[model samples]
Target chain A: MTRIVFLGWLKEMAGCAERQVELPSLATPEELIAFVAGDNQSLAEQLAEPSIRMIINKSVLAGKTLPDTIEEVAFMPPLSGG
Target chain B: MIKVQSDIFDPGAELNNFMQGRTDMGAVVSFTGHVRGQNDISALELEHYAEYTETEIGKIEIQAQRRWPGIHTHIIHRYGKMKPGEPIVFVAVCSAHRQDSFRAATFLMDSLKTRAPFWKKEISGDKGVWIEPKASDYAAEKQWTNKV
Candidate 1:
């Protein structure tokens, strides 16, 4: 089980802050995106935009593959912080 | 002392507290960031993570002290809803000369704007928009990378 966190408008629209998704160890970012899309249509629509970023741990994650661990996965919109 | 508070601060008291028993400091430079009536299109309501904001500001102060010797710094940032003409943040740096104090104060403000986890919600025409960091702020921060 991996912790999937959301923030900002994503949190407001989904009406949820975080959730645990049970997936295999080698699940990729594409797989995670597909899973989220399958679970929540509103979040899927929001994440469809290119501005949204996927962060594993504190740093941003790029490419298709997921990390070895899913201890912290954050779906953050364009950071509006100063 | 570094503080991130929801309550308003008395500038007189803060200044006095920062300056007490500092006879050797020849110059004290301070910066007060106020909530202007107009932010792009609206008034602002600022919010911040209290613990994280204070910790980050304290780190900035430590970095400033390391860069310049014999400098004292104080930063106070207020969170929660703030109106126009109210103080948002106050940074005071004291040093033996005006140049060091002035530079340190400016550096602190620049770093705070970029690194601090503070957000502003601008209210315009009954709509609230969250303000993001401008390209200008990034441009300013870019100058510091080479210095370090």
Candidate 2:
């Protein structure tokens, strides 16, 4: 189980801020994207864009590496100023 | 002092409160950000996560204090509906000299715009649009990574 977090309009669109997803061991980020896409079409469409950022444990992850534990993962839209 | 409020702020009173009991400081620099009436197409509606926004701003203030030792810092960000000419945010820094206070205040506002978790919705003629961070803001924030 991995904790996935969403923010801003994405959270409103998804209807929740956090969720727990149970996935097979050693699943890549691509696989995670597929899993999310299957569950939430709006999220899937947003994630399909290249500009969106994926962060794991506060560090930006660019490669495909699955976490061994259910750590917190954040899916953030492009940030805006106040 | 750090504050996130929906009401308008009196810059004069706020500065006095922040400067009280600070005889050691010689210079104070402050920046007040205002809501622009035109958001490319029309007006903008600002929204934020109350708890998270305050926490993030607190962290920024702490970081500023650490960077400039013995300096006083204050950050105030207003949430919800704000009109043009209204102050949206305030960042003030005080130090022994003008250079340190000036630079720190600028850095705080620049970083806050990029790292802070605030969203804006622009309302135009019969349409509304959400504003996203510009490439320039990202570039500005990236420059600080090496300094930190």
Candidate 3:
């Protein structure tokens, strides 16, 4: 099971701030994005935006590998604070 | 120190508290950011990740400390809804010299603008627009590297 978090406009598009998904197999960040988007075309497009950031387990997701014990994953739009 | 909260804070009072009994530190620099009312913006809402916002800011604070040793820092960032002209964030740094205090304050603010996880939405009437960091902000943060 993996916890997915959506921030900014993505939360409105996803209709929820966070959700849980049980992956059929260990999936990379890209595959996880594809799976999460599923049939939601709008979500898929937003997720594909280059400015969007992916953070896994509280850190920016780096490299391509997704471990089996992965926990939380967050999708965030460009940050504008301070 | 780092604080992310919804309550409105008085930057002057916070600075006073931070400066209390700190005569040994020769210089203290502080910055306060306010919500802008451009394009008739009525309110601004700041969204943040409850779990990672402070930790990320803490990381930047640590970096600033490492970059300029013997400096003390305090950061207060407000989240949730705020009206135009209301204070949104406050950063204060103290050091033995003017250069370190000034540079550390600027570095902390620049990092907060680019590296922090807070997103802002400008509310105008019934419409709200999410804002992205400007190219200048990124460029500002980039200037803190070894080349400088």
Candidate 4:
């Protein structure tokens, strides 16, 4: 199971905080983003944002693999909290 | 120490407790972030990536420690709903000298402004808006020159 979590305005846009999807095996963050968006073009477009960051199971990943051990993937906008 | 909680805390007592039993410290710098009541803000809803908030904060803390050796750090960030005037975040650093502690505290806060995975949704009247990172904040963090 791959849980894709949303935050901030993205959460408001998604209408929920997270969505769980079953993956047969390992998947890239990009792949997971598309899978979670599915047919929602708006969500898909939002996920494409250059500012969007990917975190897999609590580690902020950059050009990194989402291995089979990964259980959650978070799509985050540029953080503003301090 | 990193505590990401919803409860309010007394900065004074917390500061005392953090420095307790540490006699090698000569200077301590603490910063408290409170919810602003400006613009008629009824409350500030803090949302965070539960799986990542603490880990990211811990990473940043460790980075600061590595950058400024011998500096001790404590970070407390609140999540969920909070009204105006309530404390939202706290950062304290203790070191043998003011310079090291000051730089470490500022570095921790500066990195946290943009590095941490927490966001604020400002609610006023009948509307709510997710706050974005200010350009000034990015600039401030940039002045650090050293990326965590």
Highest TM-score model number: 3
- In terms of docking quality, how is candidate 4 classified? high
As a whole number from 0 to 100, the lDDT of residue B94 in candidate 3 is 99
Which is superior by DockQ, 1 or 2?
Answer: 2
lDDT of 4 by residue, B92-121 (tens): 999999998888899889989988888988
Cα RMSD to the true fold for all candidates: 3.9, 3.6, 1.3, 2.0
lDDT of 4 at B65: 91
Segments of candidate 3 deviating more than 4 angstroms: none
Q: What TM-score does each prediction get for chain A alone?
A: 0.79, 0.77, 0.87, 0.83
Q: What's the lDDT for candidate 4?
A: 0.86
lDDT of 2 by residue, B44-110 (tens): 5676655566777778888888887878888888877666777888888999999889878978988
Can you rank all candidates by lDDT, best first?
3, 4, 2, 1
List DockQ, one per candidate, in order.
Answer: 0.33, 0.50, 0.87, 0.84
- Which residue pairs overlap in candidate 2's backbone? none
lDDT of 3 at B6: 99
Candidate 3's residue-wise lDDT over A53-73, tens digit each? 888889887778886676888
- Ten contiguous residues with the weakest lDDT in model 2 chain A: A66-75
- lDDT measured at residue A81 in model 2 versus the true structure, 0 to 100: 63
Better of 1 and 3 by lDDT: 3
Best by DockQ: 3
Write model 1 residue lDDT over A1-82, tens digit each, in one string: 7777765556566667677878665567766776765777767878767777777765568877777777766676654333
